[model samples]
Each structure stands twice: as C-alpha cells, then as structure tokens.
Target: MEQRLLAAQALGENELLDLASQRAKAVENWLLEKGHVSKERLFVLAPKVEAATEPGKDGMKARFALK
Candidate 1:
C-alpha cells in the first residue's frame, strides 16, 4: 500500500490518489460495520504523504496520533 501511494505521489496522479482515498474510506466503513467505534481505534484518513526524497526524513512523519 505504501508502495502504491508512493507511486501515485510520484506520478502526480489524482485518480490514483482518489482511488487510494476511497480504499482507505472503505476500511473505515468496514470497521464501522463490524461494530468498531471511533473511540476504540485511531484513524487518520488522507494524510499528507511524506516526501520519500526528502533527506533524513524517512518515516519521520506521524500519520496518526492520540490527542
């Protein structure tokens, strides 16, 4: 999934990004259908993609966090 996202970002394809967003939303929907509530889990949808090319910033961005 990360690979696909990276590819989509690199290609600057909005269709791919939109598709990814839909898939992510589908996961959230699936969780809700399974009786999993928001309080029981953390979800950060459509987060900013950390540039893989950025120096010394590999996997440094937090996608989800507790507040």
Candidate 2:
C-alpha cells in the first residue's frame, strides 16, 4: 500500500512539473509575440552608390562597397 501511494505521488509530481514547464513556455512565447508586435518595421534601402567620377577628382568613392 505504501509503495503504491509513493508511486502515485511521484506521478502526480511529474505531471505538475510538466504542466509548470508548459505554462512557462506559453508565457515566454506570449511575451515574445507581444514584443515583436511593438517592434519597428525594418526598411532596407538601396546602397549608396557614389558616382565613379566626382567633379574635382573624377575618382570613385567606394564608401559602401564591402569588398
């Protein structure tokens, strides 16, 4: 009888722990969604392309060129 009771108690504890973990995950996802909802929209503009010839030097300014 005591052994059976202990087994039942362990099962109940495991279920409670699992429920708590799921609840925590639900709360985290909710918070993340809310945060994303409030975030600003990101805009990707065309890269700044300098003219290959400036008025004074006639040289290309590779300011935005990665390579």
Candidate 3:
C-alpha cells in the first residue's frame, strides 16, 4: 500500500494505478508460473472481486473487486 502511495506521489495517481495494475499482473503471472496460486484464486479473473469495491476508485479492488 505504501509502495502504491509512493508511486502515486512519484508518478501521479493514474500512473501509479497503472503501476499497481502492472505489478498485480506480474505477481499473478509469477504465481501462475510457479503454480503457487490457482487461477480460480486470482484476483484479475472474471467473477472475481473488482479492484474498486471500496468507495474510492483508488483502492486496489478497482481491478479485481468487480464480479
């Protein structure tokens, strides 16, 4: 969370969001590659939580909080 905030400060809110998105994708890919996390448990998948579940669009759920 701190990293995202720092990135937002460094790169602006939109860029920071993109950065978080990229990071999430990277982590998801890595987990999939390593077989540590199942596709069903992945946050980016459909029928999953959207990244914007909270009132603020800045929340991480904006990407995976929507189902």
Candidate 4:
C-alpha cells in the first residue's frame, strides 16, 4: 500500500485515481484468494481504500486525525 501511494505521488490526478483503484482491486483479490477477508467485506472496504488514496482530497491523515 505504501509502495502504491509512493508511486501515485509521482503521477497526475487522473492517473493517481486509476492506480488507486487498480491497487485496491488487486489487494482485494489477493485477500479474497488468501481467505483473509470475505468478498462482502472487501466490496465494502474497497471504496473506502480508493477514497483514502485519492489525490486532492482530505486524505488518510485527516480521516484518522493525524498531525
């Protein structure tokens, strides 16, 4: 996830969104395959992940009340 975000930082806004979406889907699929998380749960959380990684938004720092 950190790697994905770092790569996204070097990209344009649209590309960042695309990268985030792709990474989220990849992670979701991996988790599903590994039985770490259920498909229903992944579906619910995937949007949130993409939103958090999204550029020009509030970001995870604000969401989590970070400094």
Best by lDDT: 3
Q: Each model's C-alpha lDDT?
A: 0.53, 0.43, 0.56, 0.51
Q: What's model 3's overall lDDT? A: 0.56
Kindly provide the TM-score of model 3 when superposed on the true structure, using C-alpha atoms.
Answer: 0.47
* Tens-digit lDDT track of model 3 for 12-62: 446545665676777778888886777877666422233445564454432
Task: List where candidate 1 sits over 4 angstroms from the true fold.
Answer: 1-12, 47-67
The digit string of per-residue lDDT tens for model 1 on 1-67 reads 9878865665344544665666666666776778566745846356343345687654323232222
RMSD of 1: 7.1
Clashing pairs in model 2, backbone N/Cα/C closer than 3 A:
none
Q: Which stretches of candidate 2 lie over 4 Å from their true place?
A: 1-11, 36-67
Error of 2 at 58 (Å): 85
Candidate 4 at residue 56, lDDT? 60
Which prediction has the highest TM-score against the true structure? 3
Worst 10 residues of 3 by lDDT: 58-67
Q: With candidate 2 superimposed using the best TM-score fit, by how many Å does residue 51's alpha carbon deviate from the native?
A: 74
| TM-scores of the models, in the order given | 0.42, 0.36, 0.47, 0.46
Which parts of model 3 are misplaced by more than 4 Å? 1-9, 45-67
**Order by TM-score, highest first:** 3, 4, 1, 2
Candidate 4 ranges beyond 4 A from true positions: 1-10, 44-67
